[model samples]
Target: MVFLDEPTTGLDPDARQEFWKLVSSLKQQGCSVLLTTHYMDEAQRLCDRLLLLLQGQVIDQGTPEELIERTVGDEVVEIAGIDELQLQGLTRQADTWYRPFGDGYVVALPTQRSLLWEQLGSLQPQRLTRRRANLEDVFLHLTGKVLQ
Candidate 1:
């Protein structure tokens, strides 16, 4: 068994990749690895199961896919460059889960892109993007805070 806490925190990208390879090899050899990391991508790629902690409390635990599906669904729509009034109006109008992101909000959708488009078309957001929900989205949704 191996315990690693933020093992790749400051390593260069190449070094991180090498460490991931080593961890994968250990798993293949039937070694138990316990790893803690703030990098959601690393956790998603290297772990079969995950325990999410916030403020020293266990908030949720599951496989990466399971956690994402349960918390934020499969798709996220980002609407940016809107003012506070517009944001509030959109929040009230859209009947979905949303959270504040960079300069706008990220809305979680359950594969219904048309609904969002129809509503957001007239708003003329500076940037609009749709993407598959990931572990970071799950973390944001669960904790209501972005990981630093």
Candidate 2:
């Protein structure tokens, strides 16, 4: 077993890739690795299972895909630069779940995505983006905070 805590912090991108290759090789050799990292991308790529911590307490644990599916759903929709009234109106929509993010909201889209787009269009947000939900989204949904 090998233990690493934030092992790749501050490394250049090329170096980071090299480090990941090393870790992958170790796993391929059947070595068990325990790694700690603030980089969600790294965690998602390298780990088979993850333990999420908040305020030094374990808040959740699962495979990366399981965590994202359980917390943020299939898609993420972000609407930014909207006023308070628009935010209020959106919150009232049934079957939609959202949380306040910087200058806007992060919405976890339901299985029915078409209705969500229609509702968002009615609001005419200054900026809107839709993307597949990812580990970062899960982290934000679970902790209400962004990792620096």
Candidate 3:
């Protein structure tokens, strides 16, 4: 077994890529790796499983999809507009999982993008964006700490 601490730290993409390839090779050779990293993307890309921790305590553990389903649901909507009234109006129709995002708000949904789109359309938000709630969001929501 081998333990690596931020092995990819300060490395360029090419270096990180090569490093992961080496790690994978080690795994295939029956070596076990225990890696700790702050980059959620790196963890998601390389780890077969993850344990989420906070303040020296293990809070959660699971595979990526399992973590995804646990921290965030199906999808999230990001709305940017000129006024808080517009955000409020949209959020009212956006259901319970809505949250503020700078000059905007994000709403998490279990399913049906069309419903969210329709609600947003009715509000005529200046800029609307839609995407899945990825590891970044999961980390922030669960930890209340954004990773830059």
Q: Compare the candidates by TM-score and give the number of the best one.
A: 1
Error of 2 at 85 (Å): 3.6
Total clashing pairs in model 2 = 0
Worst 10 residues of 2 by lDDT: 87-96
**In candidate 3, which residue pairs clash?**
none
Work out how many backbone clashes candidate 3 has.
0
Report the lDDT tens digits of candidate 3 across residue range 44-114. Answer: 87788999888988878898788888777767777777466655555456543555677776666655444
Which segments of candidate 2 are over 4 A away from where they belong?
A: 145-148
Ranking by lDDT: 1, 2, 3
Number of clashing residue pairs, candidate 1: 0
Report lDDT (Cα) of residue 53, candidate 3: 88
Clashes of each: 0, 0, 0
| Candidate numbers sorted by TM-score from highest down | 1, 2, 3
lDDT of 2: 0.83
RMSD of 2: 3.3
Provide the lowest-lDDT 10-residue window in model 3. Answer: 139-148
**C-alpha lDDT of candidate 3 relative to the true structure:** 0.74
How accurate locally, in lDDT, is each candidate?
A: 0.83, 0.83, 0.74
